[model samples]
Target: MGRMIVSVQKSILVGEVSAPASKSYTHRAVFAAALGDGKCCLSNCLISEDTRSTMKACRLFGGSFEEISDKIYVSGFGKRLKVPDEIVDVGNSGTTLRFMTALSALCGSEITLLGDASLQKRPNTPLLETLQKMGARAYSKNNNGCAPLVVEGKIKPGIYSIDGSVSSQFISALLLVCPLLDGPTELSIHGELKSKPYVDITMDVAKAAGIEILEQIEQTDPTDPTDPTDQNKNSVSAKTGGKISYKIKGNQAYHLENYTVPGDFSSVSYVLAAAAMISGSDVDVKNLFPSAQGDLAIIHILKEMGADISWDKKEGTVHVSNSGKTLTGICVDAGEIPDLVPTLAVLGTFSEGRMEIKNAGHVRFKETDRLHAMATELSKMGAEIIETADGLIISGKGGAGLFGANLCGWDDHRIVMALFVAGLMTGGTTIDTAESVRISYPRFFEDMKKIGANAIEK
Candidate 1:
């Protein structure tokens, strides 16, 4: 049976909390280590369910690891990429599937990849098109472009262009496999790339791996958008579209013997948001990686909504102090920064004015239909929420007390966690699904308890 739980009524107390490991970094490290020639140490890795899924994929790709305490020592066959005897499972990890697909393409091996039920239902048509176009033999046995992908490796690559608007995971997939391209690989992207910070993180990791790319852009104005996929050879000409090209040469190597994963800003957001909403206390979270993660911008969103927040870069901590004053809702665009949408929406319900979040249609295709789920769940807690194609519009009663509600988690980690935050401010009993949160932050309830939220684990 699916599990559901409750949050005890109480305001969260403010205090200093250490940041969690970066899931983004942990995913990157897994891919990077799989390509490395020898043993390397991975420290500070977030030992979450998502990270475990990534590690499982790495194990199938000729990578071996030994975990001593909280650290991992990974040894990859490097050039000798292993072919699994059977299907390689990615679980619910999208990053694992995308990156592993591209890597398998380079190895010239026959690899069958599958994922969890939710992942199998995801629309990966764009990514499949790119991989197949780049000369990787890709076909689905079941739903096309979904999961259960079959790749005949040793791709004959030329110039490949991918749309940045689709999950940036596809872009990172190509970039990670660029080193194994047949020749100088050129990639062009068109349109306004959602989650530019994720691209930055990819490039950052690539640069550290001693791989350099020459970026070419058709023009700088993304508002005058162009689909990057329109530029590929045999690419469907979209009548009118421009492309930004990037080229990476072969025979490249990124040999890092040691890498430390930073604390996750996405996970840390919960504790910080709890501090402001429940206790109205000022707190600092330490060990966050400012250089990576697109979701770290939540601090700015919270600060704009009148939360007292600051960054201590030198000390590696984020100081968040509530004004002990009223919070007013503000209109914002959350498309590029979708993960932070839940936190902002939760905060919006406690504000004086209404909050409008536009340009986040992609939220519908996440682990669950987040926009509808969030609107429905928040409404159960007495929030006036409007569901739109683009995003959610929340009108708050300015931190007024809320009554109880039975909330659906929608099997989305962010959705469940956000409802938990909503419970803190509502001063009411909230029953939420627990299975959804296990998809990402598995220890969410324990983490919340450490910070003094009144929670009952079932």
Candidate 2:
């Protein structure tokens, strides 16, 4: 694929655009539907690069997916997954890589899974270790926890535990596959369980598919074998100081038929932030109904930063307007909302005071080290950003002393889109890796153009 460079000029945005389908929901729903017993129809599903990877993976599992009239009809493979004929390439989607890795243990024979460079860099040792404990032969090709992972079929169900600090995808991967095992399984989560809301999304989709998971908070030793790394062995999760236990009975089949994906708050964040920061801008983002998405906290965060933003939950619309008020930076707990860090960083740079984003160490393990990416790219645009071990500290200048400059997208969708928002605030900003937006929002620049943003591609 060819890369593009985008030049964004300062402009006032005003319009109403529908938010895209939730990428998180699409991933879970597609996998769940593919695991079901019969024909399932998914409406409003995201047809992006990441989601398409999930669809392709499902096909390799002996499921069939066809797009018709903007809906994807899935023929599930049930519990009888076929051994894939070729290596499963999951592209750059970490969700697909992790979830498919777990499900690969159910195949009749060995299945190998790999992804692009960014996805390979993401840590998966936590999930691989848990799968090994479940009596499955699972390991990284290089034995370093990253992908090019190989898994042999038939995991025995019993008890398993995983660390939750690095990526919630590990926890969600287990939640997706455990219910279909031959016997009952008990899963434990060690660490702070950062991005717990994503696990909630997994449970929500699983519940809708007639799968039940009983959950509770419990205490456990932090130094257990579940720890993903030896460095974190003795230290307890500072946020919870306890573990989450989940109980799932085996022999349950997924029974999904028709499911509609909710609008994505994560993708719409850039549009909303753009509307809030640019003066005289009035934009409405539609299709954003309430769901298990933690990124919905974007509304509260923007409001706390003094943006005139309101959400009509009933109508599924978020309206943002410039109220002639200067946005002021505030403290943010980013434990539950790592995807919003880049957008929040852009907002902070244009705000009035210091913005402290804490409890975001896991943000470093995303498609890119988002904390470092935002800090470096924004610094190029004349924003004073400090990179901490866990998060970012931006000394907000409120658009003062800010000048547009060439920026790097880090080949990350969130980083690119967030920098686009900052670019709108500081014209003459040019960003590479603009094509990365295809992963989540294929029409991001097109939609921004509809809202009067001067984001031109070259």
Candidate 3:
């Protein structure tokens, strides 16, 4: 396909849309099922480039997938994984690369993990170091702590410590593998953890698969260098100087069962954001579970920005409408809402007052440096944004609106989708590399068009 240019004809967007299945939940559920006993049926699993990468990795571990209607049947390895015959390629999927790196250590043979250009640039050093400490000889070929990694499987489960500030994927990766080990595994995390909610998702999947993980927070005592557990004393909290510990019993089996994936709050944020920005627009997004998703904070964030939004938990729907009222900006903490940053940034450009998005420094290590990419791309469209060390400061022009401009997706799916929403508001925005949306939401443009968004793909 050639490069696509998106423009809108109608300023008002109105329609009902169904949110895509959660990509993060689908990955975890697939992994759980692949490692589980017997045949597992997964409903509402996302079929995307990223999740497909995870499926491929599962096949490498001797698991097989069969699609029956909307449900996927996964025959697992049952804790016995065979070394893949060829290199395992995780194309542009950091979740697949990170999770598979730790899982590969369960096999007795050497296995190599590879990824596309963007995925290869993502840092996996923390995971590699943690696996090595667990008796697995894992390392990056180029020694850059990125992909193209070789793992000699022979994991000796024990206590492992890693810094949590980089990415929560490292913690989740270890959590998945620890229960399958030969001995008990304990993980201690140092530093302030970002993306903590992703870990909650991991724990949810693990629990559903019959795995029990004991978690605790211990405060650090600067005066006492001794172990806090041994002293039986309360120390500093996680906010100040504390560490989170997860203990898993080894030799645990994952029992297979039917699992249903929830709607993706990350993907639907774009729809809600577009509805809130466009005048005379009313949109309803269905099949959402707000409590289970961290990105659902988008609704609360949008409401804080003076947007008309409501959630019907019983119906699992979110309704958003502008109704001729303008959105007002406010300060936001992006630590738990990293996936919503791009869309939130787009909304900020059209809202009133200055929007400060802070605590999202970790987003730089995603498919692209999201913070910098948003600042640069939105600026090209006349947005007043300042990139900071940990976040962004966006000065909304108080409904004065942005002019259409040519933009690039930077090959990031979220970036492409967020820019598309912005394009609907501006009317003449052309985004190159629009195909990147296939990584998560393949029918993003189609869904937007159904909601009266005149996005011409040419």
Candidate 4:
């Protein structure tokens, strides 16, 4: 693909669209299968640039994968990884770089991993420090806590601690490797664990691969009845800034017969938002069965914004239409739902009041400074959005809709897609870095066009 450029104009969308497979689940499932003891088949895996990086990394670690009819058959090395002949290039996939770095500890020799410029800027000090504490020689080659990381093998199992205020990927990276260690491992998380739902996804996938992880939540205030230990208590301790501990037995073998990835709520948020923002648009996004995805909060966010949307959990479908209701703004705590911020920001453009997004500073650490990207790009289209230190404060136009202008995608998939959604509400919008959509949903423009979106590559 060349430097992709697209022009989008306002149009009424009306149709059913299938949500893409979950990229988060696809990454975890593929890694789990690659570490399994036997053959595993994964269905509905998201075939995208980021996930393809994970697949390539898995292959370097002695896993064999064959794709056939939307499914991948993987033959895992079962804790016995081969020292790769070349340096692992994760190619813009932070998850791949982190998870594969942890897995490299099992290799008999040293394994070095690196990524593109955007990914190299992401901090990995928390993960590197944790791995070193766990008896592995892991460090950033540049000594800047960012990538071009190197690790030497045979890490012994023991208790390890990592600061969780940064990316949750550090915690997740350790979760994927500790189960196969030679001895039981106790992992402790300190400080606020940003994006905890992502850790939940990792645990869910590990359990599906026949690995058991015992989780315990230590309340800052023990008197609080909403501790996760209590099955009846469904509230989160994230607001209180609690600690989490995980216990995993050693010498565990991963085994998966068949695993099917779920529909991606993160990717479909743009689709659902388009239907909700435009009048006379009725859209259904299918295959979105609920799991541990934090971005599933989009449906609740939409409903809270007064959008006429309904989600049928049984059928795994989300329906969105105008319904003659005035969409208003609401304060959103984006601590658990960082990925939805861009979509929420665009939705705020069409609302009747102000939408405040908070507790999302971690989003700055993604492939790009998403907070800055959204604020800058949306501002070009005349959106009154304030770029806060941690989040965005979007003041709705009160039906004085924005006019289209030149936008930048920042070479980040989510940023590109969110801007595309904004483009639909304001005609004559031109966006660069349009090719970045291949990182997640390669068919986004095509699918949107099927539902009557006036978008085209020029």
Candidate 5:
């Protein structure tokens, strides 16, 4: 595919647009539906490359999917999965690779999971160790922590403890498979859990599928400072001092039901940031559920940065407009909001002071190292940004003074979309690997055009 070159002449975005459905929720919902005892319908599902990978894995496990209009009707596997005739490839989706790994362990046959180049680089050792501790044989082909995992099926569920700081997907993977196990399962997280909201999404999806999960958060007494685990826990400083435990009752069955996915706050952040940066711009994003998504913290972050942004929780909408006003920078703790960092970094270029993004070290494990990508790419456009071990510190001077340049998307969907927003502020920006946006938001450029952004794909 050829590179997409985005050029913009002016900055005046105005209109109402509906946000796409949540990709995170869609992955969990599809997996849940596939494990259900009967047919289930998923409404407002995201038909993207990443979600398609998860659907493909479901089909390999004996689940069938039929698309009727915008909803997907799923005929479940009923917790009895079949060994795939070939290796299951998850493409670039980390969720698919991780969730399918645990699911494969429940079968009595061997299964191998593979992924694209980016996904292959992602660490899976923590999950493999957890599975091994639960009486399943799982190991990487290269003997490394990364992908190309082989699982000799037959899992015995019991107590399993894992480190939480690496990625919450490990815990969610275990949770997704525990309910289908032959025995009860207890998961104890030994360190600070980053992206805790994604785990909440997993629990919420499990509950919707008729599985009950009990969770407990216990903090350590600060006076007893003798534990080495407590010192390591400080890496995720945003979380409390103690481990969080999740208990799942096994031999449980999933019940099929009609499910509706909420609008994605992560995808909507780009549009909201575009409207906030431009002068005399007003954009309303519809179908957002603030309480359900952790990325809704973007609204609060924008408000703190002096952007004119407001949300009507009852109406399920957010209205953003700057009316020719400039934005100011503010410090943001991004522990639970890693997905918002890229868009926020773009918006920070248009603010008046330094913008600090902290406690988001986990972003490095995404499809690409977002902190390094944003810091390097944005700097090429004349914005001063510092990359720290945990986050970024950007010196904001507003978009009017910023200049555009040729950039690379690092083959990351969020990076491509965030750079497109930057293009609107300053024209003549060309982004290679721009098609990566299809992974999550296939209609991203179209949606931006609806709001009067001068964005063109060439």
Candidate 6:
């Protein structure tokens, strides 16, 4: 939908919702399957911008794919990727650009990683530096840390401590290619890891492909990660370069016969927050996985803010209702869940007090500088929001509901989703562009309508 406007009175929105697939898992599985020497099929893969980029990269690497409905069957020979004859274009998908850049390094050929206009502006310096440390001659073609990375192949594995300050995609990209390393790869992370759960997803998926990683924590930097997940890795000795080893027996192709993607909790935040903002509103969201998605922890955070939430893990769903209960504005540390921060801020806008979010400085480098973007857009909607060096301070009770405000999606999936959610709470229709949601959840707007939300293209 183009120029969608969501206008809803304080009313309960009903109906069913099937969440979008997990982008993290979908991307990891595709790469792992491509590295396999057998046939691997991924069912319920998200057919969004990011995953589509993964599909394209796999094809470029000479991996054959067959689509059976939403499922993708990839037959891969666990040999080196047949280097593409042309430049690989990864459109606005940071995951695709970053991971493929490293995978291309192992291809024994010269491969250039290129991306869309937005991705061209993001940094790929740290990834290049690490690939060099691994003895893979890599550099951005323009010598800037952005896209169109020219990688000269030949990654003879050695112990390299990746500076954990940048995006985890760099670390993940290397980890995916580790099993094929001539020796064990030990990574000494110099700083705190962001998106810890995503790394766990990467490591776990590697293990699933018969690749084992002996991850040992030598020292964890005192900085806060984007997500404080319980998924912890083992600490190994610096002996043997503290090498992490993955066993890929005969480079067997990992084939997932029937794969079911866990429901994306990040997409569910809009529905839940909308319910909380509406007086006497109650909404039931189905097919949510409590065990999956670090952002699902938002349910507990929302419950603490006085929303009635019921979750049945067996049924894989959650029901949220607030029967005229006031949303109490409370302080929260959103560093661990930066993606959810935008949704939380919007939810806070309807609360009665000031909400302080801390340890969230890294939100600046996401699909957009989220802290600035959130503050700017929320201010446009008449919410009193304070921009901060690290996080945000939002004083809610959005002035008798927001006025009709025009928002810039920033071509960021999270911002677009949050703005659309704000539109639902705005007493009048809020206008926004929907192009960015395709980066993560292309079906987000369509799913919003399934929940009985009043949203239509202008």
Ranking by lDDT: 2, 4, 5, 3, 1, 6
| Candidate 6 structure quality by residue, lDDT tens digits, 1-458 | 35544333333566667767778888887888888877877878777878888888888987777767768888874665687988999887888998888888887788888888778878888889988887779998778888889998678666667765567788888888766766666666665465555676787777777776766643324332332321222111111123232332222335444455667777778878877666666677777865435678778778877888878889877888767777777776654466788988888787878887766676787877889998998888888889898778888773365664777777688987887777776645454556677778877778777766776655
What C-alpha RMSD separates each model from the true structure?
A: 5.0, 4.4, 5.1, 3.0, 3.7, 4.4
> Which stretches in model 3 have alpha-carbon errors above 4 Å?
1-5, 219-241
**Candidate 2 or 4, higher TM-score?**
4
Q: Give the per-residue lDDT of model 2 (tens digit) for 22-65.
A: 99999999999999879999999999999999999989989999
TM-score of each: 0.91, 0.95, 0.94, 0.95, 0.95, 0.89
Worst 10 residues of 1 by lDDT: 228-237
**CA lDDT of each candidate?**
0.73, 0.89, 0.84, 0.86, 0.85, 0.72
Which candidate number maximizes TM-score? 4
Q: Is candidate 1 or candidate 3 better by TM-score?
A: 3
State model 3's lDDT. 0.84
Winner of 5 and 6 under TM-score: 5
| Best lDDT among the predictions, by candidate number | 2
lDDT of 5 by residue, 1-458 (tens): 56665555555899999999999999999999999869999999888999999999989989999876658889998867777899999999999999999998888678999999999889988899988888889999999888899999577878889988889899998898898887788999976688888998999999988898998767664443222112233333324555689999999998858999889999999999989988889899998876456788788878877789989988989999988788888777677778998998998877888888877799999999999999999999999899999989999876646787989999999998998888888877878788899999989988888889776677
- Model 3: lowest-lDDT 10 consecutive positions: 227-236
Per-residue alpha-carbon lDDT of model 1 for 280-333, expressed as tens digits?
666778897567676776777677777777888778888877646766687766
Model 5 alpha-carbon drift over 4 Å, by segment: 1-3, 221-241
**Least accurate 10 contiguous residues by lDDT in model 6:** 231-240
